[model samples]
Target: MALDFTTTQWITIGAGAIVSWLLLKWITSPSPKKFTVKVPEAADPKWTGKVLENPSIRDPSNPSTIVCYDPSTGYLIDTVPNPTVEEVKELYNRTAAAQVKWAKTTFEQRRTVLRSLLAFVLENQETICRVDCRDTGKTMIDASLGEIITTCAKLRWTIDNGESVLADDYRAPGLMMMYKHSKVVYQPLGVVSALVSWNYPFHNAIGPVISALMSGNGIIVKCSEYVAWSSKYYEQIIKTCLSVNGFDPDLVQFVPGFADVGEAVVQSGVNHVTFIGSPAVGKLVQRNASDYLVPCVLELGGKDCAILLKDSDLVQAIPVLMRGVFQNCGQNCIGIERIIVAAEIYEKVVEEMNTRIGKLRQGSILAEGEGVDCGAMTMGNQFEKLEALVQDAVSHGARLLRGGKRYHHPKHPSGQYFEPTLLADVTPEMDIANIEAFAPIMVIMKHQGPEDAVRIANLCPFGLGSSVFSADKKLAEKMCMQLKTGMANVNDFAVNYLCQGLPFGGVGISGYGRFSGKEGLRGLCVPKAFTTDRIPGVKTPIPPILDYPVQSAKKGWSFVSALNNLVYNPEVPAKVGACVDLAKANI
Candidate 1:
């Protein structure tokens, strides 16, 4: 267009054009291309769902029809279906069938398979750690030390020493039975049902199986439903090893489910049962086993206590005790839930603990990364329990030293995260004092002396594990001997359970029996007594003195009297004369 304008008018026209161009660019832009890095998908999208869904159903098109969630984000990880009642029945059948053949195999053959499993675990440790960390909401360090490596070490120990442990034990025949040879032989209990806990899923799942298989019993591991994903992969590894070693894969199978599935297995005519979980549930398992008179081992939860004596060095004790308290986020059954400190160091220890707890980092637990100290709670109810415990204690006059509530991260808001809570002035009457916190909560109680510390530690019904931290070795040993725990750690804590050679278990409400050592290996088998007459042609002989009839009247009475005198008389010369009389009567 042929138009004339002043210089100011031209400038106004240029500014309007610039503004319009900028507006147009903003409208038509690609919105800064929202930066996102390409990464491998963690789990199959189709299999993710609520845990309560019917996991028995399988979709042919999908990798898994069952679903489980990631605790860190409350998002679906993947579903691996728990067994239905029918499936559990099938598992029992398979286990029973496998037991027949497994029991027939020699101990060497059984040891071979166990060694193979250990080798597989050692070889696939990285994969195991990753799956464990993902499924349990624990750090890789925990999965590595607590689950994979620890289990492998146990398996190695089992393979090396299980043979002699299960061998026939010979007994010395008493003087009365000098003419007979006595021996005790171990026989396999047919099918063993192992109800594994979720906290240390890998270790708990495989531990009983090791003993059961080593003793020639077929085992079916019923995995916790909350940690089905880890179980699935673990089952795969075990089955693969079994198949490769030419043993029946059913010798050790995993049936995943909730409490119903575990109960079903217990009620399914299994020869023996082993359960590792809470005391309430352990009692249920015992009751269930009682119906059939099937012997069961219950490794229940512990309110493990740590005692810091007046002679304890704070520098040496604090880190070890904190690790004992907060390791696995205090989800460990043997973790230090209660700390009884001497009055001399109660305030100092509590103050230092609170300060140390504050320095702990809480966030999304990563499988591969470092720097995360505390992670999300694996189960939803655990978060609630932690909150309730703290509230209950605080309401009951307990002083909250640090972290009195739940924690939330901006990026991982859905996760069940809690702070490392510390409480002081906790009394025996308080609910938190008696209960297993099973979280990163430390309860501190002051004691008058070493005896008071022992008294307080022994007050709990649970006797799984207790510890004494002291600079005095002799005094600590004395305290350890006095503690009624199944196993006691002196100076350090909780690591005593990791010793493969030591027997680990509890007494009273903490449950009964032992595991992880010679007793455990032998416990998996039934004892059979064998006796044979050492004298030739003396078969089917019973002591004539024990016969019902009082034959030879006076002579028989005199012989019996003389035998009693020989065995139970107080004076030595009279006993000698009675022995001579007894021999003369026999002659």
Candidate 2:
């Protein structure tokens, strides 16, 4: 429209055009600051709900009490009281006091209560799903199943298997008339501080929460500030469930805020602390626990891997890998951010992956129509970190095969929307490929064989979960054993099996303790072994028909059945002794 223009004016106009183009590209790209998804109504057929309309907060004067939040919509989650060391100490004392009653409750009683709660959770699965959806901004379907159903499954598994898991015990018969009666018993660790992360706050945190509760411990939770509302919803439902199921209402309580609040609560000397979070926080909690001689279960971060063997069906592998990468929009702790593809068909697999990656419909998550396969970054930091990783790869000469930009779903530009991204030609040296990209970005790399694949997969500071895809029985079995992770999948996504009544934990930077399963009970309990004699005044010692039973004088020859001998287990017995001593100190 201009007949003449100055150099400076043209420059300004050009710069503006470039800036506008960049902004538009960013706004229209697959990455958005925060994306919101429609909270689902159910984890199963019985679940249902709508977004919460308006929720109320707790009365400041009585902040120790919690206000029930709607399960349909996570609203007004928790209100923190000004907690002090004395209050914390008193809380622990009360927890200890409560444990006696709860522990005395039969395993059937605990199981009965948990079974009722499980049934209720399943019945209200939809409401729980929607609550999670509201809290995490994940797709309702994923949140419902991942958070709600998974939590319910874990609770049910623990209830069903808690007693038997603790029943198996043994003892070694010492040489001579001496014997060591060895038995492993699971007792509640008394007061446990449950620290939940923001990512999967609704469901994942509850696994340990229920586990601790079923094992007869009082759990005080420091919920994620980012999704505090969900914490409130949990307190509401769980408290009601406990009351109805005949458990103490004080068993579970919610504390809200940032690190300062968490520190204050942690420093209060709770009996045991169970934390699910990043490595930094995990270390801090561990340090605090060490100072107080309080036991803690630290479940930290993960840079999980997905291995594709030569015989893996490319068709099945593609979808499995897709879900592994994109489920929870890549925010899952077990999300397989790095894929190790076999070199025999590396290009073929990458090509197929690219084709399927294209079909992941990126759109407005909350729009009325059937939306995209994914949603957005649950946290703003995650969004920026993902964006930086893509830029870093580009700067380092790695090719961006699928996504190199951010975008809002065309219909809902205002919502957080990120196109699922794929990067190829990305070497293991690239930080994004090895570091924690806790977002919706996935980097694909090739591996020559199982040994090489495992090497690359294990080349990380974090070892949590891993999945191996192959039809070969021998290779799958080998990988399952050799894979360096707390949990390994032979032919499925690592997070798919929530019903297995096994502990879900990690190694290295991933976590230090196990949750769910049988180990879950042991993690939150003390193993107290005692040797007792029926008669109070009678002193019994190892006695034998031989001249002397080792070096004992007290007569118990009636029960002597073996000849005198020596000690064994070598240094293992000493190490075990040290561990037992440490365990006793922790309790």
Candidate 3:
């Protein structure tokens, strides 16, 4: 028998259809976007009709795309002088030639010249700051003092600390009448290629260069096209300043190049390559390294998480979370991209997050210290990509609790700025939270409990940095252990690892080799050993057994020394006292 639909069942089906249609309409509705216009110069404004007008592109064969900007109008300035491939090659050859002499110079000689260069950098802070602001769209306040100042500090620190890594370690004279010996020391490699990013141009370039150079290696630095001029010419200015101070200008050379040049620079049979960029390009560098079998340090992308559980202080967690996501317009590799909130505090956290996001005041790039909340993205295409991600998430059922739109001033239509935006109801299932949005947007995800938060946080393919906000010490400890990330902050996001003298590297898709801190410094070189010998009847303790038969009279002393040293220094002995001291300690 066939079943027939009842009147109540038919009415229920009709109601379901109406509800589904209404839901579809709500999802497709156009969310309104607002903007505030900003004009730089009303007195006199000049528009350059060329995107490649940066003077650096002047060379025909070794052409470059200029990154010039008019500060008054936030307009892409004009063409300047681009360092051609020829210029890049010339710089490479110079560095290659000078590296031979530089590597051979005594540690003190290198140290002296490095110090002089640091001094030169200090003297040119003003000009460097202006160039940084114009080239990359970062305010001078951030670039010069923030980026350059930190770069200078790292330069001096790397120079000073580098010696310790290369310091010649000697093994004490061993037992065969000082005839046998072993040695350990730090040896320098040939030229190294440093491929840097634009976010923190100066610091990004200086850190790797300092480490590689201090290890007695020649280096070629490839800057992001966004700020290639800044990175390439910095060394020249320092060299010019140092010439008067009489530092060896030849020891360091900076060259500007494109992606092709970057590829060529890394593939040119260099000793090592240290790269800080996206994983795709990093992989390219790593593959390039395979040809020559050279080692590389690749710092890539990260989808870091920030967890806010019950009882967490909204005041503290709120600002830190915003900073973790919004710093440098949310372009940081280790910046917070995911916010996992515990159900108990989910609504409260969302309310507070919306308040903070709402307070953001978008403004021109030149707003040095303006109360303005954020600046334009340095990379224009990045803005469009970020917009698409937000729209996709909205279309896929994620509801925007706040800031789901972009604002533009009609007058300055060409301005690259985007509004500070936040989205709530983001689920792990949504691509919005899974992939990285390298822009000024933040996403908040809800969780049933701490277990769910941890599960979702660890779900991403990335494992760069993570944070847990809990008054409970045990929970914080446990979460840090469970998460598969390189660095985790208990009450904070990342800002913790910056220049704190700690090693920082990602675990999963982040990258391969480590840099910064002990592991980083050590990664720049290989360890070597040194050995020496001492004679028989040398009161070598005779294994603390005077009656023991000798393997060989000549070899007897070595055997005894090895046995005695085992009781004392498991390595090699520096002094009788050291041996005796180590023996008692180890024994």
Candidate 4:
């Protein structure tokens, strides 16, 4: 057989082949080179050890400035301006105005902005981690895992999948409306607001910004006053990224203040709000957003649990358990606050964990070498509450295996440090078992069986993330299904969050709505449903029998009933009778 092609057709085929090859290479290429950042032997020489015990305190002289300092080394970081409520409103207005123009930009333009941010993060991963460590009192390793890596994953996922997620979705019009076309067009929702906590300052600040800009909306981030120092630096990074990408930097804004500022942001007339904080504060945000009838997504506190069955692999599970409890100085919302161990291995697990906890060296990460296993807590005010909870638990027959109180670090007495704690024989009746002890305390409860384990795990009001470990895959899966949480893992812990495609959120006191993944990106936009004629000349016209004049009301009713039956009836006889009746009614 012989085939011939025109020159134009050959050129088109060649161009398509080249494009396909280039796209394949782009998708399969390895990620940017990951640099190994070394922990500094000492704090930054610029740190003057001038501690501001309360960063939220307004400078009496200036009244408009917040005293920001390092929680770890007690070093004076810097002072950030505390914007007034009126300033917050004005900031939101400017952001909304810029969003009007941004919403008109193409997906490619948005991708460029995200790519610039991704590149900035990759190039300055060390600097980002250092800033986060300074502000949050977390170790460099913790910052790498919680701040740098998570932010990069989110940026990468959004850049690759955001356009498709926001694209118009064509839907079937059904048989009766076959001549019509229907679709859901995702459109921008103007300005959105996020009130983020200080734990993962960099990640929290950048996360909402990425989603909002990708969905063609502006964002105003209300950062915690505790991390105001780092928030100022992050705000500069975002603005610089936007400006260099030829975007209006006003499209994104960061407001750093106390409760009044957060309340102002929620009621700032933004189209939507996302809040990440305590359950107490989340309720306030919801109430304030209700004033404008604006929708909100709240990611609140959690008492995440890990259940270890008798047959579970201790070698593999112990490391995961350690990381899950001690990560981010146990300030993680999803960190395992409770551990349910089978009675058979309960004592062994306690012994193993206690030995590990004894060796954990805690100090200010910024003060010395990388030998420290855990860093200082972000806030010292919570120490009293945490101690009270532990003491209450001890009073209730819980065995305090090790570290029952706060530890004053020998090297840095000013720093907030809590000993890595291991408390065994924890019962549901104990206050510590039911409350969200967001600290380094590891509470272990004995479970006779899977049912008892689940009961203990679900005792807390929070229903966030959970983990079930067992050698039997079937049993593990079954128990995981029974756990009362938004997300669960079998033989794993917190791996769901590492996979960026999965939505992250919870139920009950943990709060409602989802963030991350496709659900999150779409949630930021309005799903506008629209329909039009499928063919150029095809149209729907009002029938004479059912016209507004209603010359024959009885006939109009009969006509509608027959039409519905003809389209919906499954039996041939019924459809035939309906057709006949429709004809008679029309006449």
lDDT of candidate model 1 versus the reference: 0.79
Compared to the true structure, candidate 2 yields what TM-score? 0.76
Q: What is the TM-score of each candidate against the true structure?
A: 0.85, 0.76, 0.75, 0.92
Candidate scoring better on lDDT of 1 and 2: 1
Full-model lDDT, candidate 2: 0.68
Badly placed stretches (over 4 Å) of model 2 are 1-97, 168-170, 176-181, 363-369, 409-414, 495-499, 533-539, 542-587
TM-score of 4: 0.92
lDDT of 3 by residue, 453-537 (tens): 8999988878888999989979887988899888888998775455636677887778877787657766666666654444443
In the range 137-217, model 1's lDDT, one tens digit per residue, is 777666676888679778878877888888888899876677889999999988888898888878888888888888999
Q: Clashes in each model (backbone N, CA, C under 3 Å)?
A: 2, 18, 33, 0
RMSD of each: 20.6, 19.5, 19.5, 5.7
Descending-TM-score candidate ranking: 4, 1, 2, 3
Off by over 4 Å in 4: 1-24, 27-46, 51-64
lDDT head-to-head 1 vs 3, winner: 1
Q: lDDT scores for all predictions?
A: 0.79, 0.68, 0.68, 0.87
